[model samples]
Target: MEQEKMNLKLDMDVQKLETKKLRKGKHKAEEDLKSLKTDYKKLRLSMRTVGLGKTLEQWCQEIQEEKIKVGRWERKFQAAQMQNRSLENSLSESQNERDELKARVAELEKTVHQYRNRNSVVELKASFGRIEQMKRTVEELEMALQNCEAKIEYLEANDDHQSEQLHYFQDQVTKRDHIMGEAVV
Candidate 1:
């Protein structure tokens, strides 16, 4: 009878230890669940803040919109570049004409110098009239050259403005690319 009582007491102690271990395991699992819930919430909030929570369809739509904008900018840049080339060509042509006029004027002045050395009065009078005519032509050429220079200056200014606009558009493209990269990541 005493041996049976001792066995019963030992069984009770074993059951109590098992119950305690089970209770500790349950508590640990609850704590782990709470931690997971908090971490999940934080992750969701971060995703929203970083713009990563957008749907795949939304991202695709945005990317398409950006592509359209980029295409428009590229077209504008090409047009501006073409205009710039044209302006450069015009300036080159104007310079060539100016140079030709200068050469012509120099030749006329040399002819006048030769005429001035001649001894005939009639020849001198005729040469003087021709000289006046040449001078008027030279003045007109000078005026035309001045006009060409003004046009060149205006074209250069316009080219500068177009270059600035190109840079601005390029910066916008870079910004869009960065945004797209972030979205993809």
Candidate 2:
């Protein structure tokens, strides 16, 4: 009977030890699972951050490229403006020269009339030659004036076309800026 009691006690102690070991192993597994879950959450957050960073960098590069394009357009517009002003100045100078030539021709015509009434033969011949020369000069001046007028017209048309182009570019830039604003929002 005593031997039977000792064997029963030994079996009870083994069962207790096995139960404690199983509880410890279960606790360790739970801790390991919690740690793995925390690590996964951190990795997901880092991935999101990296994605956002790449998106921001791409946006910045696009903005910089847009700025460069705008700068080039502005420079072209300014150059066109300067060219228009120069053409205007040239047109003014040509008009002034035409007016002066017309005045001189009128004065020559009056002198020719006075010479025609004189009776000296040699003086009459000289006056006739001078009149012919003056007429040729007047014709040449008229032709030059006409050419200047045509050039002025061409320049004015060109300036109008350039102005239209500049407005179109400005509108495009404005639209791009609006789009970017919406995207950022």
Residues 63-168, candidate 2: write the lDDT tens digits. 7987897787778767777776776777677678767767776776676677777656787677667767767776776777677677767767876887788788
For candidate 1, the per-residue lDDT at 112 reads: 66
Weakest lDDT window of 10 consecutive positions for candidate 2: 47-56
Q: Please, what are the lDDT tens digits per residue for candidate 1 over residues 1-185?
A: 98999999999999999999999999999999999999999998788767676799988997898779677767766776676677667667766776776677677667767777776678767767776776676677667667766766776677678668767877987897678657756
Local error of candidate 1 at residue 117 (angstroms): 1.6
Which model scores highest in TM-score? 2
The ten-residue window of minimal lDDT in model 1 covers 86-95
Q: What are the clashing pairs of model 2? A: none
**Please, what's the RMSD in Å of model 1?**
9.7
What lDDT does candidate 1 reach at residue 41? 98
Give the whole-model CA lDDT for all candidates, comma-separated.
0.76, 0.76
